[model samples]
Target: MVTYIARRIGAGLAILFVIAALGFVMLSINTDAVVRGILGPQASEEQAAALKADLGLDQSLPVQFIQWLGGVFRGDLGRSWFTNQDVNELIGLRLPISLSIVIVVLLVTLVVAVLLGLGSAYFGGWFDRATQILCILGFAIPGFLLALILVTVFGVYLGWAPVVGFTPITDSLPGWMRSVTLPTIALASHSVGAVAQQVRNAAFGVLNMDYVRTLRSRGIPEWRLVLVNVLRNSTVSGITVLGLQAVGLLGAVVLVDKIFAIPGIGEMTINYTVRGDRPAIMGLILVLTVLVIVINLLVDVFVSVLNPKVRTR
Candidate 1:
C-alpha cells in the first residue's frame, strides 16, 4: 500500500511538472504580446526594453522558468501585469467563492446521480427509461447554453432565483444559496448525467453477477441483495466517475460564474486572459493543476480503501 501510494504521488508530481513546463513555454512564446499588454501599444522600443530588463524578461527562458518555479515552491505566485497586484492575493480572494460553488454543485450532483442511478437500476422500467432520456439530454446540452436557459426560465420567467450577480454567504446565507442555485444546477447537469450513467451501468452489471443471482435464489431480500452486493461494489466505479466529474465541475463553474456575473476564480481567470496577464494566467494554471492532482490523489486513496485488490496491488 505504501508503495502504491508513493507511486501515485510520484506520477502526480511528474504530471504537474509537465503541465507547468508546457504552460510556461506556451506563455513565454507570446512574450511580445505580454509586453504590449503591460506597456501598451504606444510604448517605444526603448521603453519596452527598459521594462523587460526591469521585469527580468531579459533573462534566459530557463532562468526565468526556474525563478518562477522557485517562487511557486515558496508560495509566491508573482504579481499580475495588469493590476500589479499579487497573483496570490487575487486568487486568495476569489478562490473560496468558486470553490464553494463547485463543492455545493458536487454534493448536489452526487445525491441526484446516486439516487437516480440506483433507483433506476432497481426498478428498470419507465423510471429507468425516463432517467436515461434525461441523462442523454443533460449530456447533449452545453453548460453555457444550459446556464442561459436556466437563467431565462427560473430567473426570468418563474422568478424563482436572482437573474444575475452573487451574494456572499457571510453577508446573507439564504441569499447566497438562492443566488447559487441556478448556476449550480447548470454546472452540475453534465456531471449528474455522467455519474448516473456510470453508476447505473456498474450497478446493473453487479446485479447480474452469478453470486447476486445465487443470493436471490437463496431467498435473500431483493433490497439487501441490491444494496450489499450491487451498490457496495458499484461505488468503485461511482467514485471514479465522481472524481472525474469534480474536475470537470471546476471548469464548468468558471463558465457559469461568467454567465451569472459571480466574482470567482473563473471570472478572475477570464479577466486576466482578456488583458493578457501572463503572471496571473500562470498562477491560475498552476493552482488549477495542483487542485486536479490533489483531487485525483484523494480519489485514488478512496478507491484503494474501497477495493482491496487495489491495495494489494
Candidate 2:
C-alpha cells in the first residue's frame, strides 16, 4: 500500500510538472502580447527593453521554466499579469467558496440520487418509471439553461433565494448558504439525474445476475440478497459514472456561478477567459489540468484497490 501510494504521488508530480511546463510555454511564447500589455504603445524603446529585462522576458525559456518550477515548489504560483496578485493567493481566497459549494451540492445530489435510485431499483413499478422519466429530463437539460430557468423562476419571481452575489460565511453561515444555494443546486441538478439513473440501471441489472438467481433458489431472504450483494455489485457501475461526471463539475459550474454571482474558482476562470487574460487562463488551465490528472490517478488507484484482478495486473 505504501509503495502504491508513493508511486501515485511520484506520477502525479511528474504530470504536474509537464502541465506547468506546457502552460508556461503557452503564456511565455505570446511575446508580442506580453510586451504590448506590460509596456503600453506610448512607451519608448528603452522603457520596453528595461521592462522586458526586469520581467525576465529576455531570459532563455529553460531558465524561466526553472524559476517558475521553484516558485511552484514553494507554493508560489507566481503573480497574475492581469490582476497583479499572487496566483496562489487568488486561488486560496476563492477556493473555500467553491469547495464548500461543491461539498453541499454533492451531498444533496448523492443523498437524493442514491435514495431514489435504490428505491426505484428495489421496487420496479410506477414510482420507478416516474423517476426514470425525470432522470431523462435531468440529463437532457443544458447546465446554463437550467441555471437561467431556476434563477428567473426561483430567485426573481419567487424570491426564495438571492438572485446574485456571494456573502462571506464569517458574516452568517445561514445567509451565506442562502446566497449560494441556487448555484449549488443548479450544479447538482443534472448530476442527480445521471447518477440516479445509472445507479438504478446497475442495480436492476445486478438483480438479474446468475448469483442472485442461485441465492433465490437457495431460499435466501430477499432483503439480505438485495441489500448486500445487489447494491455492492451495482456500485461498480454507478461509482464509475459518478466519477466521470464529477471531473467536469469544476469547469461546468461557470454558468451556475454567473447566475448566483458566486465568486468561485469557476467564476474567476470564466471571467479571465472572457477577458483574454493569458496569464490567468494559463494558470487556471494548469491548475485544472493538474486537478483532473490527480482525480484520474486516484480513480485508477481506487479501481485497483477495489478489484483484485486490477491490483494483480
Candidate 3:
C-alpha cells in the first residue's frame, strides 16, 4: 500500500511539472503581445522594454522558467501584470469560496445519489423509472442554465437565498451556508445524475451475485443486505464517478460564478484571461492542476481501501 501511494504521488508530481512547464511555455510565447496589452498600443518601445524587464520577460525562456519554478517552490506565485497584486494572495482570497461550494456540492451529491441509486436498483419499479427520468433531465440541462433558473426562482422570486455575493464562513456559518446553497445545488445537479447512474448500475450487478442470493435465502434483512453488502461493493464505481465529477465542477463553477456574482477562482480566472495576465493565469493553472492531482490521489486511496485488489494492481 505504501508503495502504491508513493507511486501515485510521484506520478502526480510528474504530471504537475509537465503541466506547469507547458503552461509557462505557451503563455510566454507572446511576450510582446502581453506587454502591449498591459501598457497599451500608444506606449513607446522603451516603455515596453522597461515593462518586459520588470516582469523578467527579458530573460531567456529556460532561465525564466527556472526562476518561476523556484519561486513556486518557495511559495511565491509572483504578481499579476495588470494589478501588481501577488498571485498567491489573489488566489488565497478566492479559493475558499470555490472550495466551499465544491465541498458542499460533493457531500450533497454523495448522499442524494447513493439514496437514489440504491433505491432505484433495489426497488426496480416506479421509483426506478422516476430515477431514470430524473437522470435524463439532469444530463439534458446544463449547470449554468440551472444556476440561472435557481437565481431567478430562489433568489429573485422566492427570496429564500441571496443570489449575489458571498459571506466568509469565518464571519457567520449560517451566512456562508445561505451564500453557497444555490451555487451548490446548481453545480451538483448534473453530478448527482451521473453518480447515481453509476451507483445504480454497480448495485444492480452486485445484487445478482451468488452471495447476495445466499444472504437473501438465509432471511438476512433486505435493508441490511442492500445497504451493507451491496452498497459496499458498488462504491468503487460510484467513487470513481464522483471524483471525475469533482474535477469537472471546478470548470462549471466559472459559469455559475458569473451568473451568481460570487467572487471565486472562476471569476478571477475570467478577469485575468480577458486582460491576458500571464502570471495570474499561470498561477491559476498551477493551482487548479494541483487540485486535480490531489483529488485523483484521494480517489485512488479510497478505491484501494474499498477493494484491496486495486492496491495490489
Candidate 4:
C-alpha cells in the first residue's frame, strides 16, 4: 500500500511538472505583447526593453523557468504585472473563497448523487423514471444557463439566497451560506446527475453479482447486504465519476464565480489573463494543475484500497 501510494504521488508530481512546463510555454506565446502589456502599447522600444530587463523577461527561457520554479519552491509566486503585488499574496487572499465554494459543491454533489442513484436503483419504476428525466436535464442544460435560472428564481423571485456577491464564512456563517447556496446549487446540479447515473449503473451491476446473490440467499439483513456487498462494490465507479466531477467543478466554478459576483481564483484568473499578468497566470495554472493531479492521485489510492488487487497492479 505504501509503495502504491508513493508511486501514485510520484506520478502526480510528474504530471504537475508537465503542466507547469506547458503553462509556462503558453504564457510565453506572445513575448512582445507581454512586454507591451507591462510598458503599455504606446511605450517606445527602449522603454519596453528597459521594463523587460527589469522584470527579467530579458533572460533566456530555460533560466526564466528555473527562476520561476525556484520561486515556487520557496513559496514566492513573483509580482503581478498588473498590480505589482506579490502573486502569491493575491492568490492567497482569494483561494479560500474559491475552495469553500468548490468544497461545498463537491459535498452536495456526492451526498445527493449517492442517495438519488441508490434510490433510483433500489426502487426502480417511477422513481427511476423521474431520476432519468433529472439526469437528462442536468446533462443537457449548460452550467451557465442553469446558474442564471437559479439566480432568477432563488435569488430574484424567492429571495431565499443572495444572487450576487459573497460573504466570507469568517465574517458571518449564515450570511456566507445564504450568499453561496445558489452558486453551489448551480455548480453541483449537473455533477449530481452525472455521478448519480454512474452510481445507479454500478449499483445495478453489483446487485446482480453472484456474491450479492449468495449473500442474499444466506438471509443476511437486507441493509447490511446492500451496504457491504452492493454499495462497497459499486463505490469504485461512483468514486471515479465523483473525482472527475470534482475536477470539472473546479473549472466550471470560474464561470459560476463570475455570474455570482464572487471574488475567487477563477475571477482573479480572468482578470490576470486580461491584463497579461504572466506570473499570476502561471501561478494560478500551476496551483490548479496540482489540485487536479492531487485529487486524481487520492482517488486512485482510495480505489486501490477498496479493491486490493489494484495494489498489485
Best by TM-score: 3
In order, how many clashes per candidate?
Answer: 0, 0, 0, 0
Cα RMSD for candidates in order: 1.7, 2.6, 1.1, 1.4
Put down candidate 3 lDDT per residue, 277-304, tens digits, no spaces.
Answer: 9889999999999999999999999999
The 0-to-1 C-alpha lDDT of every candidate, in the order given, reads 0.88, 0.76, 0.93, 0.88
Query: Stretches of candidate 1 above 4 Å error?
Result: 214-222, 311-313
When 3 and 4 are scored with lDDT, the better candidate is: 3
Tens digits of per-residue lDDT for model 4 on 1-313?
9998898888888888988998898788787887886677789999988888888889998899999999999989899877899988888999899999989998998888888888888889999999999999989998999999999998899989888999999999999999888888888889999989999998888887888888889899988986677788877888988899889988898898899989998899788888778899998988898889888988888898899898888
Displacement of the residue 15 alpha carbon in candidate 2, Å: 2.8
Off by over 4 Å in 3: none
- Candidates' TM-scores? 0.94, 0.88, 0.97, 0.96
Tens-digit lDDT track for model 2 on 190-249?
888988988898888888889899999999898888778887777665566666767778
- State which candidate has the highest lDDT: 3
Error of 2 at 252 (Å): 1.0
Q: What is the alpha-carbon lDDT of model 4 when measured against the actual structure?
A: 0.88
Q: How much lDDT does candidate 3 score?
A: 0.93
For lDDT, candidate 2 versus 3, the one ahead is: 3
